[model samples]
Structures are given as C-alpha cells and as structure tokens.
Target chain A: MTALAPAASPARTPLGSSIARTLRLGVLRAGYEIRVYFRQADAIFFTFLFPVLLFGIFSVAFSGQGNIGTAPDGSGGISQGAYYLPGMAAAGILLSGVQNLGVDIANERSDGTLKRLAGTPLPVVSYFLGKMGQVLVTGILQLALLIVIARVAFGVELPTDPAKWLTFAWVFLLGIGTSAVLGIAISRLPRRGKSATAVIIPIVLVLQFISGVYLSFTMLPVWLQDVANVFPLAWLAKGMRSVFLPESFASAEAGGAWQLGTVAVVLLLWLVVGIVVSRFTFRWIRKDS
Target chain B: MNNIALPDAVVSVRDLAKRYGAFEALRGVSFDIHRGETFALLGPNGAGKSTTIEILEGYRDRSSGAASVLGTDPQSGGLEWKSRLGIVLQSTGEQGDVTVRDQLAHFASLYPNPRGVDETIAAVGLADKARTRIRALSGGQRRRVDVALGIIGRPELLFLDEPTTGFDPEARQQFWSLVHQLKAEGTTILLTTHYLDEAAQLSDRAAVIAGGELVAIGAIDEIGGAEARVPLVRWTEGGTRHTERTRTPAGTVASLSARLGAEPTDLEIYRPSLEDIYLDLVRENAEAAAAEIDADGPTSPTTRPSATDPITEGASA
Candidate 1:
C-alpha cells in the first residue's frame, strides 16, 4: 500500500466554512471595539461618567420639597432630583447609542479601515454587530451607574416592583436600538466628517434637550413635546418615570405615562427603519462629502 | 498567440473596462496571469494599475468585461474565494492598538489554513519586533507587517502591489528571498511596481501597461530583448580613452589586444541592463502620450461633445 499524504482534513464544505468564518470574525471585531472604548479613556470618561455626575449634582442641589406619585399635588410637580433621574439615564445611555456609534463609524469609513476589510473574510454584519455590542455593554454600565447614584447618593426612590424592572429593561433596550439606528442613519448622510465630534456633540446635546432630557417634556412647547414623543428617548423616559413614579403621577403628554403597546410599536418601527436605512443609506465604507 | 497550456489561469481579465463618468480610467484592458508564476504588471502612475487591482481585489466593480480570480469571478465570488487570495496593497492596512503578533494571530484565524503567527512574523523578518505595536514600527517595519498579513493565510494566489516600496538594500534582498519561498509554494503572484530592477530580479514574466492598455508582455529575458543589441565597451589604451560598440565584446577585446600588442587598459563590457530597457520604455510611453495629445490637440476648450458630435475610445482594444 502507498503511504498517503496528511492534509488539512478538507474544510467541511462551503456552508460550514462560511459559518465558522462569520463567527470568528464577529468575535474578534467585538473584542476590538470594547478595546477601543477602553483605550480612548476620555471617550469613556466623558460619555458615561460625566452624565451620571451631572445627574448627581442636579439631584442633590434640589433635595426633597416635592412629592412623587401625583405631580406633587401641583406643588411644583416634583423634586428636581427625583424628576431628573429618568431623563438623565435616558440622556446618558442615548449618548452611548448615538453619538459614539454614528460619528466614529463615519470617521472609520473615511479613514479607509472599513474598505480594508472588504477583501477579508470578515462578514459586514460582524463589524456593525461589534459596534452594537459595545454600545450594549456601555449602555448596561450607564444603567447601573444611574441606579447606583439615584439610590446611594441622591436617595431617590428605587422601583421595588418586579414590573418596574421589566419595564426598565424593555425601555432601555428600545432606547439603545432606536438611538443606534438613528446614529447609523445619520452616519450615512455624507456630510463632512473631518470635524465629526464637533458636529455630533452639539447635535446629541440638542436632541437630548428636545426629547426632554434636560427639561420636562411638559415644559417644552407642546409642538416640540409632541414631536419628541416620536423618538425613543421620549418613550424611554416615559417608561422609566412610570416605574419610578406611581401611575397617578404619570403625565398625560407621555400618553398616559407608560403605554406598553405604544412603546413597543414605536420601538419596532424605529428598529425597522433603522435596519432599512442602515441597509441602504448607511454607507458603511464610502462617502463623497 | 502562443497556445500556452496554462495550469488554470489564476487571473483572467478579458476586456475589463471601468468608466468613471467622462473620465474613462480603463478601456477594454486584457491580460491573463498563469498560476505558480511571478507575473509583474509594470506601469507608470495613473496608468490604470490601481483601478485594475481594485477590480481584481473585488473592491470595485468593473464597468464591463469579465475578470476572474482563482477560478471565480471576483465581482460575484463572495466570502469563500476572498479567503484564498492574499493582497498586499500599495497603502498600509489599518492597525489597531495591539502587538504585531496578536494582530497577525487574529487575522490568521480568519483564514481556513493560516500559517502559525510566530512563523509568519519570522518570515516577514519581524521576529525581533513581534511584540511592538504597529504605531511604534518604522515605515519599513509597517510595510513588513502589511506583507505578513498578506501571506498569513498561505494564499494560493497573492497580489503584491508595490510590496517593496520602502525596503532598504539588505531588507529588499531579504524580501526577495521571502517572495521566492512563497513562489516555491506554488502561489501565483501578481505584483505591480515602477521598480524595473526589482521586476527583473523577481519576475519570471512581465506585462507593461500604459494608457490603460498592455503595451508589452513576455518572458523577462526575452522582453525588449537585449541580446541582439550590441555591447558597448569602454577603456583607456596607451593613456588615451576610447569607446566602441560591437556585437561580440570578446572579438573587440581580441582585436584591441592585437592592435595594441598588449592588454587594453580599463576594458569593461557594457551590456544594456534591464534599467536601460525600462527607462527607454517609459520614454517611449511618454512620447506616445505626447503624440496622442498632439493628434487630438484640444481643438476646443472642452472635450464635451457638441449636440452633433459624439466621443468614443476610438474603435476598441
């Protein structure tokens, strides 16, 4: 008998190889994205830590003097501290979803890194999934930080109800999905990305404010408040406040505080829109402007 | 054409065309690169080299014609085919904040049959600097990293676009040896470079491209073949300098010995090197460009056709 040459046990067909390739690429990309966040100390410091700090300052500066559940019996609505928690959490987490994902992706595309991977076996989904994965991690961290500050430092009421925790998770995930897709859509618009942070920062701040991140949605012009409801931030804040505050205190403008069905529909729509726009308009690798 | 029984033509580009609006970058350019051969694509700047490479790399779509790489059309072959080919671009690939070893290892996993990361690092002469972050490496070291990544997959067909742009003399020789190793492994290589000396040293066959068209292609020895071209001998005899051209330099030296009744002083044979042929080709390419311009000669301010006139790439390739 002739001796046989040992070979690489020929790859398990095209389908199996493709699946393995996709998984490996995705994991590596996800790891790199988290590493990028760690390396950019300032981005982590600014995007996450500062927003929680800002919440703490405002929550402490205005202590007590207001009630929860029924809009303080019209006694100045509620304590500034209690009132700001939901908004602050929404704002902080939204920054992770939008500002970081949108601008950095645009910058990467322009820098030719995105194009460099085009020839590699790395699936396109893996890279974007990596971004979303990073955002999710940061979002979870931001959520924990916000809760810790609200409880330990500000001494604000923590929602003890099982339902409230469920609400928070759903709302938080929705907010992340909506904000991420919005960022991706924004990234697709071929604007001059050289001064990316400069443009994205102000826009992020403005959107947060418009969505009642800083001021109450009720205080805003009714037209603006109505428009804000169309976004994930408004729904997230509404859902968060519903859990923190009792149903009676829920604002009518928030469409009866937490309409779970409405929140679900809006989130789903945002998810669909995000996917469609990212698929077509999101120039993940190219830009003329 | 010669009926060359190719071992599965690795790169078969048939009338590949790319038209960017009014600017036609490539017009029906055609070439075939056989497997297990170092085929050099020689061209001047803006000679459609990049556009051609980009199309072949599956990064850009050709406007027309077919281009197949590794038996699959690059435009259509999705992920599986890409993993089999290695491409070293003229530009450096992206670097993240990681050691060179880690980066190579990570990329190695992306391919089915990747070489060991440590071995690849040694192959690229980066064993000493394996732990260094890419940002810390010099321009030459960084270029080496690009080459390492290109070969980590043990690709069957490797495209090296100016792979030795920043190599020192010693490093260039080292790189030549490494490329020889790759070639020995039966990796069909397609390299584009302006360096004629590098091409002559490495390539078995060469194809010179100009004006978006292949000007010449043949074996490196037979290319612009030089053999029939007379050798020029220069020397000083009897304290007087003299130079003469002859078909047979040996015969010239013999005649000189007989005439002087002694050995000619400072006698040196000067067969035209590949450098001479390359420069002459570049000059001729330039002259052709000038002549084309003179003929077309912009009779109007713009090349935009009037309502009655239409512009075309003059018949076709």
Candidate 2:
C-alpha cells in the first residue's frame, strides 16, 4: 500500500481581503441555517406563523366593530383589520428577530454547538452575520404572511404610495436589526437550553403588551404610554401605523402625530444599545471559563 | 522538568495549570509532542485530560503557564493558525437536521486545504450513511461523523479526545487503521483514551496523569520505568501462595524448584502488561496522597488497604 502524503501548506490570503471572505462564509452559513430552521416544526409554528394566526383571530373578532379613527378628509375611518395589521406585522418582526434568535442561540450554546465552532477557524463575526441573515429572511416572510392575510382574507387595504412603502422598508430593517442584536445580547441570560424558552418568552410577551402590539398605545394609561416610549417596539409599531393608517389617525397617537423622525431616532438608539450590550456579553464558550 | 522547548515539537506545554474557583482541575503539567508522533494522554475520569486538550484547542483559556500549538500561543492563535489544527472534542452537541455529507461539506469549506468529503466519509467507514441525517444514525455511526469532521480539514495536527468511546470492537479496529493512516501521512496526533490496548497499539509515546499531575511520560513500552515491568514468579508452597517479583523469572523459578519444590504447585510467571504498570502507578500516587493527608492532620480516618492489594504485598515479598 502506498503511504499517505503530508498535507500541503495552506495558501495565505492577505488580511485586507479577509472581510470579503468573512462575508462570503457568513452568507454560506445563512443558507445552512435556513435549511435547518425550516426543518424544525416548532420554529415554523411559533416564530413564523404565530403572528398570522393572531392576525386572523383579531380580525374576525373585531370585524363588526365600527371604523377605528377618522380620516383628515372627514371620511369614514379604516376597518379593524387595517388598524391591527401594522401592530401584528410589528409583532412578527419582534418574534422572528428577538424571541426566536435568543432561544436558538441559548440552545446552541448549551448543546455544544458553540463549543465546537469556537475550535474552528470560522470568525465569530461571521457566525453572528449568519444569525442576522436568518432573522432577516424569516422576519420578511412573517411580515408578508401577515399582510397577505390582512388584505386577502380580511379585505384590509394596503398602502400603495411609494413614500409609504419607503417608510415601511426602513422600519422593517431597523426593527429586525435592533431586535437581532438584542437577541444575541440576552442569549447569555439562560443557563441551559431547557430554560431558554422560559426566560425569553416572558420578556418578549411583556414587551409586546407594553409596546402597543397587543393594545393600542393611545388607549393605554398616560403613564403606560410614557413607559412604552422607552423601548424600540413602540416606535416600530408606530412607524408601521404611519404607513397603513391615514394622516388623521396620527392625531390619535400619544404625541398627537406619527413623529416618523422620532421613530427613526428611537430605533437607531436601541440598535446602538444592542450592539454595545452584545459586545460585552456574547461568548464563544460558557461563563465557566 | 526541563523548560527548554523542543525545536521540532508541534505541541509544547510547560507548567500548565487550570483552576475553577477552589477546585484545581489541572495542576502544573508539562510535556512535548514532536512532529509525526502519536502521543497518548492516559488518565481516569476527571483527571484533566479533556481540560488540557480544550486549552490546546483554544476552546478554553488556561489559568497559568505556557502552551504553544503549531508554534503559536493558543490563547492568541488567529484563524490562520486555527485552520491548521483539527479538534474532536470529548462530546459535542451537533444538530441532527443535516445529512452527514452536507455537514461535512460545510465544514470542509471553512478550511483552506481540505480532504475530499467522500474520501473522509469512506475513511470513517460511513459511506453507506452519507445521505442519512445524522440524528437517525446509531451512536457508533454518529461518532464516525465526528471523526469525519475532524479530518476533513487536512489538519497537520489532529486532537482526538476519546474518539473511540462508543465504537464496537470491529468499528474500533477500523478506527485504529484510519488513525494509523493519518500517522503515516506525517500528521502529529495527540489522543486521549481509556483503552490501554488502543494506546499501546497506536501511540509511540505516552503520558499518564493522576490528581491533575503528570505521573509518567516516556515511550509507550518504557512508561513507569523498567523497575515497574519486572516479571513475577508465583507458586503454591505448602498451604500458602507466594509471589516474588524479580528481574530474572527463570533463575528465580530454578532456585525455588531446587529448594524442596518439585516444579511447585500452580507455578506461573507473569509479565507486567501496560495495564498492570498503569494501575500500579495510579495506586502508588493515590497512596502517597493519602499519606500526605494523614501527615497533615489526624482529623480524617486512615484509608484501609483492600484485601486484593497484591501489587504492594508482592513487591514487599
């Protein structure tokens, strides 16, 4: 038998070009991540489809209720389906980006997946990029499902104006990006995989309730609106409402206007917060080291 | 105790120590594994074998002391350095969603120079299960996947931590042949295993650790020193059994037969196997620890010798 030959030395790529390599690996990792994610029945039901189900339920239950808020032209208000559409879409982004990613990371950490990856040459930044890409894809699909159910199933009118669509795009991007960063930051809170759901669900649920996803922001007590103003989800939902609701409905907001500039500023601030927190908290291995 | 780092050594660990709060998982330990040599780290459970391997793999930070793998300190080893080493951890929690081939392919892409995925799969004896999802594979089959991932990178130095833990006898033989092939390719291997026979078969040199310290480090057959490998002559004399450890078993038996002994009853000569030498070294270390504890104070009860303390009694005899 012929003896095996020694391995040849690896080709050295310059450091300046490593960023491009990292991005390429990150995209490749995202493909595998998406494939694995779709195979899990629970992830599909909870993270991707749960918002659609909630929208369907809320639309049917509130179908007979009169128009929501009056328009500036003295025309009739929009239907209940149109009113709750933005909120549910905002919630979908939060579910896919924050809750799903947080628990998924905790499981990977406890199950030795992170430990194995740490031993490899794959950069940690590339890994995070993979998670962000997964969240972006899943979040977009979730938003589409919500909008389709609202328009086709419940006869809710979607925004057709280019300016409104532009607003929708920025809100969607900033909301999911900030949420994804926060998800990585809080993944370290749960000590084990079994406890990840218990720890993350309550936090996400509480945010949904307080941030105008489950309840109208203006309908809540003045103090509660003040509290909701502190977080990003409130701004995300308000931004979505600006796209779907008529101009007069903006008067119903706590600030008496959509305040699109404030929405952008608040989400940007939270994105920064997530980045700083995750920088300090994220670890390749557990805290035992 | 020599602090001089060998120039050709692929792994040089000197005065390494790791502590987890009050518990010291690894005391000061030192060893060097040269290129193309299969070195075994043998120890019982919780004996710092995994800890040392983890530190070398850069998965865990060392508490103190020096560790240089592939000529770079593991704590600061960059991606270029990491690409050259293969690590098979003691246990990993790989997701079972992907097919074995898919999993191996993704990992192969991460390396600058990688072996063919199908060739690696065949080497691990999992060709038939390539299309199968990893979760559906049997325990032994899943372990082969771990080995496949470890070698797909064409690592110059491969760290196999208990790689054969769940393998059946036949599968273990196949794995041994695969490891031999890797060694033939001039890969420096550091293996940790509970199987003494496996170590004796594969490793050129070995180090035994106990109580977080290196007890013996030398050539596989020469571990525990020549003094520990003496032959024993045992026979039943009158109504009692006697065992004598000697350098020359034939001469000892000859003298005994001439002294009122016609071939003796149940006469047998026993050569100390690697297992025997290993057990003796661990037991001696344990007894020395017990003695030190006793010397410190009389608060704890003394450890009583077992009835089958044959090594101690035979050596005294």
For every model shown, the clashing-pair count is 0, 0
Best by lDDT: 2
TM-score of model number 2: 0.91
- DockQ of candidate 1 is 0.29
TM-score of each: 0.86, 0.91
Residue A205 Cα positional deviation in candidate 2, in Å, after optimal superposition: 0.6
DockQ, every prediction: 0.29, 0.38
TM-score for the B chain of model 2: 0.89
Task: Give the per-residue lDDT digits (tens) of candidate 2, residues A142-228.
Answer: 888788778888899888899999999999999999999988988988877889999999999998999898798877888888888
B22-103 per-residue lDDT for model 2 (tens digits)? 5566788999999999999988776778778878888667889899998888888898888888988775666689999999
Docking class of 2: acceptable
lDDT of 1 at B160: 92
- In candidate 1, what are the lDDT values of residues B1-317, reduced to their tens digit? 12322457888888888765565567777888887899988877767777788788876678888887877778776777878888787764454567799778877876777877887888888899888888788888888888888888777788898888888888888888888877777778998887888899899998777666677778887776654346888989668888888887898889888998887788899877766766667678768866776788865222322212111112121
TM-score of 1: 0.86
